[model samples]
Target: MKAYAVLVPGLAASAPADADVRAFTETYEYSTQPEGTTSVQLWHTARRVTWDEDYAEEFEHRIEIKHGVSEHWDVATSTVLVQSGRNGLTLDRVVLGPRYRFADRAEWPVDVTLALEAGKVADRSIYPLELRVVAARDIDSLTLAANGIVGVQVGADVIDEVDLAIGWAAGASYQLHNKLRIGAETWGGTADEGPRPPTDGVNASVGPVVHVAPSSKLWVTGTAGFGLTDNADVVAV
Candidate 1:
């Protein structure tokens, strides 16, 4: 039996809403589940302030569903079905994509994955593609893992906002046990909206993550992150 873990941390920022007003601003990471398995995730995020001089608190509730297409392939979808505070409680966009893992070949020390995502953002549609590399080395009683991601945003909405937008996410983790692991992850990106790459400045967060496997059919994860830069949310717990 095999299991899939959501070890990748999400990129936090603002997402465009209806009327091209940039109404709601925020974000995350999408990882695939294990083969022959179905997973449902409930994730939440909270913010008190931002870099735009807006002093408002925001909270978001996201629901994600993942199904393994094969041993090395997965299809997943996530939706911000509920939200509150600054963004208000409303249905947000839904993103669906497939992720493929290059685990059969051992030529490279790092495991690689390519993913493509597209869906609705408010009333607009978007297509974002990413490539992820996972590097891991196991030591006595502990396992260390490193991950890096790079991608671009494409769609009618994105074209209206910038010529080309790129984003990246990187993080590392330590496995304390087969069912529990702890780590710190930082993710940020840039687009054509500003001077160049990392245009709006980089937003970073440090935090602890926990994963529990209560049974072969279920796995649970919880994470809390504190903002490390002015561009990030004050606290996401």
Candidate 2:
């Protein structure tokens, strides 16, 4: 059978509830997410902490590896399978958090997201019909959209407040004078209002995505940001 999908990496993938969604596209597509891009990310997060921040530097040499699939990463109909691992050094064990992703452009033609909100363990790795609306234009030099997320975990124990959260993000992508493109995104949200509260903090980050190829099967992108939440958001790699 012809390969409808290629194996890209949802490698930059976060947690279903806490992972940052903006940086996910490049990891999933393993290239550039163009107009007709469709992909999936396999991600996870793990962590251990101590009340005494003094021991924060105690952890060392943590490693992990995971795998999943993607659509439209290398090709539109191509299903890209992905596997990734991670390592870290902190006061405790593997860092934990949820994952997040904005829907593919073709689905909304503007901006949209489907996400879950939990930090420790994932409620479900598959898309669960959780979506956020986006408002933008069709084909413009710059694409801007505003979206938010709200979700709960059913299979696990519920404390009502632990699952409910408020989060929103604004993202934009622009094409420069040449093939070089510029893109940026900002996102933040709050989680854990439960009794045994996982972690009550705000999660926010902003970064730029560079598209060297602009329009090509192969491309490169890198990102950096800070996340403040008690969620388990693990990138496959």
TM-scores of all models? 0.68, 0.44
For candidate 1, report its TM-score.
0.68
Clash number for candidate 2: 45
Model 2 over residues 1-237: C-alpha lDDT tens digits? 001111233433231221112322222211133322333323222222223333221212222222223332222111122222233322222222222234545565554333222222223332222334334443666656666655443333454424455666666667674445567656556753212346766655555555443322233334333333434121111
> What C-alpha lDDT values do all the predictions have?
0.51, 0.36
Clashing pairs in 1: 10-29, 13-26, 14-25, 14-26, 15-25, 15-26
Error of 1 at 85 (Å): 0.9
